[model samples]
Target chain A: MASFLEFRQVTVAFGDYVAVEGVSLALAPGAFVSLVGPTGCGKSTLLNVAAGLLAPSRGEVLLEGRPLKGLNPVAGYLFQQDAILPWKTALDNVALPLVFRGVPWGEARERARVWLEKVGLGRFLRHYPHQLSGGMRKRVGLAQVLIAGPKLLLMDEPFSALDIQTRQLMENELLRLWQEDRKTVLFVTHDLEEAIALSDRVVVMSAGPRSRPIGDFPIPLPRPRDVAEIRLTPEFLRLHREIWELLRGEVLRAHAGA
Target chain B: MRGLRVRLWQAGLLLGFLLLWEWASRTGRIDPFFFSLPSAIAQRVWRWFATGEVYPHLYITTVEMLLAFALGTLLGVVFGLWLALAPAVAAVLDPYVKALNAIPRVVLAPIFTLWFGLGVLSKVALGVTLVFFVAFFNTYQGVKEVSPLVLQNARLLGAKPSHLLRHVYLPAAASWIFSSLRTSIGFAVIGAVVGEYLGSAAGLGYLIAQAEGVFDTTGVFAGMVVLMAFVLALDALVGTVERRLLVWRSKEREGGSA
Candidate 1:
């Protein structure tokens, strides 16, 4: 099958500093792919390239066999920080993508209402981002991105700010949402366990000044895995050890450089 | 109950101050000729209202203030967004913006009167100058500080330039603009009154200046009191609008739990 999204020898640099160099990645349609790396590993830069927010200095990103010239036309990005409009209610924020697409106000709002309910925020339609808890805001963010119905979902450490318990719940929530339609996702994170638990294929990236993917591991874990309960399984532990062994050296190198 | 208590204390303080002033004037502790009795000022204000003598002056001042504020805010927001989004232009115009901002805007009142010829336009021009910087600086900062993550996410979700401006940029800058409303209104009042005080056919400032010319201290005191009341009313209106527009921020401060 043709890749839904492909990066061809992509490189990004900030003047004298090269953030990522010669990085090539691909995601098949409806696949769950996680890009994991140590701090400062250019995971976000790669994600930005895929989203077409930042054009690569060297190579290009191809979406469905065509080179993307500008912002990706069929992608939704969930940022690490709170990206929802602070002035808007949850309902308005969720309705925004539709609104931007020139959807009529009434119909867009009706659809947004459905999406908000799907994310379990039926009672929070009128609540502002500030009024919602960290986890609730994350749910709102999820609803916001998914409401747009993009083919490619790009998430950059979206739940890193949440506590451990909230993180697991959000992880499970993400999985549940992904299971419904299984849209192609390029999720970036530093958490090894999260990558193993939520992803079908985990791609590890090396530390920067010049960062690129160093290893790719395919997880043969069973479907419908619980993020919290999966940790105790023997197979899960073995995969964690194998990936962590390769990830630990790069993490130490990043720490020493910092 | 706490709000009511605070209001009662506020009213009590005002009443005590007025009573003391009236008593002191009556007892010959202070010369009523220069200081003016509180009762005399109150009576003057009452007669002006009853006979409708102050209506035209009040109308002129109100119109001028509103025009200046509306026009200034509009121009400020437009120019601010324009310059902030264009880094090359912003760098080129940096020194000039600082220089213009540094000049005492009050000095421009005389020039404005001379150029616009002491009508409502002169006051409005002066007011615009005063209010413009307050709105401009706040708006400039607001646009410049919009979250990069939000912009990126919006683009990935298929927001065009116009869509981003309407949905993201305007809403982001609105908080900053609303915050500066009170300050800009105050500047508007200053510009209108000062322009009229210098030279104008009608306005609250003209009334005060006319009274001072003839040494009618009571009329001057009455004018001052009316002006104070007018400003307070305008401020209260601004407070209402701000609360309505920035409900998200206020809720954030309240820390409403999800």
Candidate 2:
């Protein structure tokens, strides 16, 4: 498969403290890939580099055979914290990307209304981010990112703050959305099960101070999955066990280093 | 019911304080010549309103206050955004900004009066000097505190510099700006009144200053009463605008009554 995004020996260092070093990875178009790592393993650093928010100290990123420069133009990022503008209502928040693109207010609003309805927030078009529950805000964030229709989706632990039940629901929602178009996804998280459940492939990073990918595991699970139900399946358990064996050592190493 | 009780108590307290003052003056418990009776003050104020002698002064003062408030807020936001976004400029001007802010701004009233001549322009300049720092500090803090994640998300969403300013930076700073509205407005009023008291020929402050010159305590007290009412009205107006603009903030976070 042709690579949609390819990182060639990317290294990021802040002064003398190296966050990640010589990490090279690639994602095929429409592939759902997750980078799983222990705490402080710099999984997020790689995602930032991919999104072109942070420049790698060395090496380069090629997006669809071209060298990526500045911010990746065709990506939508869902942050770990509430990223939706607090001053805007749900409808306006979702419409902002289109508005930035010079879409007329009336037309953007009409499109936003449709998107909100699709995200099961039709009644909440007028609600602010603060008015929504945590899970609901995540839904809005998801809708806000998806409305722009980016070819690549970069999520940095987007649902990690939610309760387990809400997290699972969001994972399923995400899977459902991705199935519709299968835009290339680069999800970064510490939760192994979550990475395994949502991703077609899981890339694990070693502990930090110069973190790099140590293991890449193919999930091989059947698609259209319910994240909760899939966890109970034998294949899923086996994959989890296998990945955890590799991941446990890195996690211990990180803990000891810290 | 609790709110009604609180309102009633507030009204009762004001009524009692007025009655005490009236009694103290009428019975000559204090020198009535200096501390004029509240009834006399009320009568004077009513007569000024009935004959329409207060209109011009009221209009001038209001114009000065509004011009100062609007101009000060606009300049504050623009400069605040500029300084915050440009780190090098902010660093270079940090000491100058601090030194300027440290000066007792009231002293500038006389200079402004001399420069602009005892007109609305002088009063507005004084008011702007007083109002600017509050708005600027709030805006600076607000813009600086904007989440890195949010900025990255907007960038990933294809926000240009202009779009980020309009949608992200401005809105992020707005909450802080709104929070400082009452404080800045109070400064504006002080600027106008002080400018008038020091030199202007008209305005409520001029009326009070003139009464003080001749020892007409009733007139001075009447001017004070009118000024109090003016400030209260402005405060109420600010509250209405804040509620309207900040509808997206949760009521609880806004610290509104339950």
On TM-score, the candidate that comes out on top is: 2
Q: List, residue by residue over A232-256, the lDDT tens digit for candidate 2.
A: 9999999999999999999999999
TM-score of chain B of 1: 0.95
In order, the first chain's TM-score in every candidate is 0.98, 0.99
Query: What do the candidate models score in CA lDDT, each in turn?
Result: 0.90, 0.89
**Candidate 1 off by > 4 Å:** B1-5, B251-258
- The TM-score obtained by model 2 is 0.95
How much is A241 displaced in model 1, in angstroms? Answer: 1.8
CAPRI quality level assigned to candidate 2 from its DockQ score:
medium
TM-score of each: 0.93, 0.95
Pick out the ten consecutive residues of candidate 1 chain A with the lowest summed lDDT: A79-88
